[model samples]
Target: MDIVISIASKIAESLVTPIGREFGYLIYYDTNMKDLKDELKQLFEMKDRVQESVKAAKRNGEVINYDVQSWQTSVDKLIQKVLHFEEEVSMKRRCLYRWNISRKATKITQDVLYLQKEGTFNNVAHPAPPPMIWSTFKEGFKDFKSRMTHVNRVTEVLKNEEVRMIGICGMGGCG
Candidate 1:
């Protein structure tokens, strides 16, 4: 019985940690895309509830109930979907980057041809616009901003200044 409980605890920890990490990434991605935010938010909430249920079961020294298992299964499926969505987004970004590079190269070639035909390189009035910003760093920062807002709200409710300071510092470091 002891071994069984230990194994269950380990399994729950392993599953919960990855799910949380994946949910965090999904949230970060959704910050700019906004397409998956609502669905991911629902999954996150469900994960939280499932985690609470597991904790409760552990505290009571009871085996996880069927309802908890069902919740866990649903969360697992949602996480898988989120991962698939991320992969699709990455592929799309790569294709867009290639397209942008090709377009810029073609424009540069045309400009050079015109310069050669006109026999003047001195009258170019405007430089090409900067390449499309492909990195998702901006979206990630927006996600961080939202997380910071939550941290601030939690800190405001904390009675201990030292603890609040630590929490804020911890969140900043994570960012």
Candidate 2:
């Protein structure tokens, strides 16, 4: 008797859980869309504010972060989704379709919220990294006495009119 009761309870709980969740989605479909619309609006505002910062960074010749660029692309794609959803809503939509649309709106709303949190860019853009060639040569270059003598000889060789071609060989690095 005890084993039978336990099995019954488990089966009942599993059925009840899914039914309850589906019912919630169906019942709150309109509410979900409204909340999603409001969140999307706020997301747009946040995106605009961030865009201003990106613009400022560009003007100052700072390189934008990869994450920030990715976020912008995501927002752009979301705008299209919202537009498509809006058109669908404006048309004659069936009650059965409500759940699907509601689910989509809920997902997009959550995405917008996630994006808002990620939009916080304390370091939106950073100073661009120096070119590798510069770092490899100029940055680590030292004016050693021996190196300077080589430099003088190279310059004299270059100044000679008969010298059509020249090559720099030695340390081949900052040395």
Candidate 3:
């Protein structure tokens, strides 16, 4: 009986740890996409605001008196450009997030299977870390480090994409 219990505990430990990590990945993917979805919504709102601004600029009599056709043309072009850039960025971000999630899920599943073979199957039963939980490479966090790195890269790309859009708009306004 003691021998059986000992083997069972060992098997449980081996199975649980990997399971824990995989479950963590699943939670992270869900939370991360939801966060990104929120950002996309904000971007959409900003796009609407930009459109409104263009409309208001077109309707202002004094502005039209000063540079009517040119101003309207510039505003329309700028609005279109900004919107196009934003749409491209949003699409790219969404696609990258999806790809990362699918990749993470697969990796975690494999890890779980591997751990089951080794013993701690139930360790990953809990929700995973939040999207922004940056783990140190040396912290022994396992398969998640790679996925986290991918998430960070996507974040950076989104940041740069936003910056690019803002810079273009700023320059257009000045010109």
Candidate 4:
């Protein structure tokens, strides 16, 4: 009797879970859509603020951070998804349709909330590092004798007032 009851209960539970989840989807359809729309509006506001920062940073010749740029890209893609979902959900006709749409709306609502949280970037950008700049000093010299002569020569040449151009030409590209 105990073994039979355990097997029956397991089978019953497996059947009820999906049905209950679908029912919940139906029940929460309107609420989820409203929350999704509200959250998306807030996300848009954040997007605008971030975009303004990007614009200002560009004006000041600053390079936007990689993560900030990536976030904006994700926002652009999500915009398309939201537009399509909103249009599709507006004409709710069938129970199955609402069930699936509600599920998607719930997922999108969560996504929108996540993006809104991520949009709070403290620093959008910074001045770009100068071109061809290197940190040879920090790493230290591997061959001090060979490299130091070249370094000292270049430094000495740079200090000379009369030398207007430097052309360190050598066989096998020693410079």
> For this target, which candidate reaches the highest lDDT against the unseen true structure?
4
Worst 10 residues of 3 by lDDT: 166-175
lDDT of 3 by residue, 67-125 (tens): 33443354455446545644654565464555556444354344333322332122212
lDDT of 1 by residue, 1-175 (tens): 9999999999999999878755554344424344344445655665665577567656755556554565467556646755665565566655445443333333333433332343322221233356696764545444578677877887676856667344334534355
Q: What's the TM-score of every candidate structure?
A: 0.32, 0.70, 0.25, 0.68
| Candidate 4 lDDT over residue span 1-175, tens digit each | 9999999999999999989988999998889878888998899999999999999999988999999999999999999999888788777669899889989998998888888888889999999877896654565446658768997999999999999999876663343
lDDT of model 1 at position 47: 61
Whole-model lDDT values for every prediction? 0.53, 0.85, 0.49, 0.88
lDDT of 4 at 29: 84
Model 2, 1-175: lDDT tens per residue?
9999999999999999888877777899989988997998899998999899999999988999999999999889889888998888777478878877787778888888988888877778999877666355646467788778888999999999999999886657544
TM-score, model 1 to reference: 0.32
Which candidate would rank higher by lDDT, 1 or 4? 4
Ranking by lDDT: 4, 2, 1, 3
> Regarding lDDT, does 3 or 4 come out ahead?
4
Best by TM-score: 2
lDDT of 4: 0.88
- Superior candidate under TM-score, 1 versus 4: 4
Candidate with better TM-score, 1 vs 3: 1
Model 3 vs. true fold: TM: 0.25
Model 2: lDDT to the true structure: 0.85
What shift in Å separates residue 28 of candidate 2 from its native position after superposition? 0.6
